[model samples]
Target: MRRDELLDAAEGLLCDQGSAALTLAAVADRAGVSKGGLLYHYGSKEALIKGMVERLIEDFDELVAAQPGETYTERYVGATMAAVRSGRLRRWAVVTSASGNLFLLAPLREAMTRWHREGLSEEPDPLASQIARLACEGLWDVASHDPGLNSEDDLQALEARLRALLASTA
Candidate 1:
């Protein structure tokens, strides 16, 4: 299969079964590709996961880059809300939890750190960003693990509140 097709299969596997079921062989089967083909694209499971993380980071960066003249706070809040709306971030969070893989945290942390640093003229205080990030993450965590909290209206309200909070920081 094609490279994009392989990654798409991997992402679907990750979303449906979490990271525990994301074996290269399984991904290959899901993508209808040979094991060797999967290996050719991603030499190992670690590499595959790393690539996913990288893709997520790149996606976020592209979102940020797309808004040329927006304030840092606006870009940050917009990118985060967009992620929530898309649901990929929530799926990635679940996959990370299922895998117990610390490596996946690095890129996210780096992105947040850079945003915190460049987003302000002061001493790079990330408290506001962290609070917003954690709030969204909390929403995702609750929604993923608790069926009772799965309300789209509630999520939209939470996203609005997050945007308000992020805006207040600017």
Candidate 2:
């Protein structure tokens, strides 16, 4: 299997067991590869973490690019909402914890900033986007950490409402 497949498996393991369960030996075992084989692909734990971050960023970039051509506000809202709805944010939290590297988020933050600056053609409403983004992020964080925050129906309704807000603003 490819390195990404290994990382994906590792991320799943992280979700299942948290940081305590994400040793390289564990990843290799889960991936059905020997420790030496895993080491061959990733010389060290740091290298493996870095590769996971790179893979995550690359996948995020692709997701952003896959959206239909629309206004900056629309695109951003759609992308962000897709992230929330798909439960990717929760999965990402698992990956983040396993990697134990905050720097991994830098590329994502930079990409978002660039998308905001270049995509919004009108009078840039930085505050609005920031608020919306934060709200969505809050929803994801809460959903990931607190299962009682919203029922499935409640979350779907909230997502619809958020999408409407984004559409109207866009």
Candidate 3:
């Protein structure tokens, strides 16, 4: 739990305070622990970022699993919307992109690459799967920069339309 708290502090520093402020000392300060204590758990910024990425992956998977769906395609679509709406995806995008650390960035890419190959669909409707996945990815991009660009009503309307389209094809 202490490790998680420190990581949460680091994530806050990255998402709210900007990646530039996400230092070992800053995380220690934010977490209210000694710098040495932070070091004892994380060893360095790279390790912290790695942990964040791992935790992010786990959170995403868990959330996706909780959504109602019988197949990967349906759950993935629902998970994408849930992730975007929850601001989890946005926070992750900002932290990783702005972190400017390749070592921290590399594993995220690698993990996603593996998940993509394994988790996504190669189904009867390849085009539908691709379009749905791509649209969700675009939404993640939009939500990351300026979430206020779309209101709650607008997002719900859009989600309804997308789900309807998916249902029609089913």
Candidate 4:
């Protein structure tokens, strides 16, 4: 869809140039759409961000839907592992870091609040599940943004350890 294309272009811009460089003109140029078209789809950066958040929720939902596990906790672990491997969430770094001062981020905050509530509802051991999620998320973020932070062997070992931790909890 044109909307998805525009959001993808905007995300690419944020990843490559940081949020400071994201402008309507840049997004239009990157998306190969006219500025008017861009405006027609998303009136402002805030709306675009909301779109991205919605896209994220959809992507995660797809992962859950495709999960092989019958229980929510098992599926959560599977989806979390898949997300780390699939590279589907790296631009979230940009979203968090986007325009420290200018962007209101209220919608983003609300969306995530609701997602957290709904997404993790069935986990019995919240602390353990949260620990696993945090560890996987931290590793994925670091691996995506700064590969130099850990050698490939180190990363493999850390992943093995994380898996063990998850298995123990599960």
TM-score winner? 3
Best by the lDDT measure? 3
Give the C-alpha lDDT of model 3: 0.76
For residues 58-163, what per-residue lDDT tens digits would candidate 1 score against the true structure? 8778876765334565566566656656665655665455445787567767876776566565423357767765565565556556545546686678767866
TM-score of each: 0.73, 0.77, 0.89, 0.73
Question: Whole-model lDDT for model 2 versus the true structure?
Answer: 0.69
Per-model C-alpha lDDT, please? 0.69, 0.69, 0.76, 0.70
- Point out the higher-scoring one by TM-score: 1 or 3: 3
Q: Return the lDDT, model 3, position 130.
A: 61
- When summed lDDT is taken over every stretch of 10 residues in candidate 2, the lowest stretch is 118-127
Error of 2 at 80 (Å): 3.0
Of the two candidates 2 and 4, the one with more favorable lDDT, higher being better, is 4
Number of the candidate with higher lDDT, 3 or 4: 3
Model 2 residue 75 CA deviation (Å) reads: 2.5
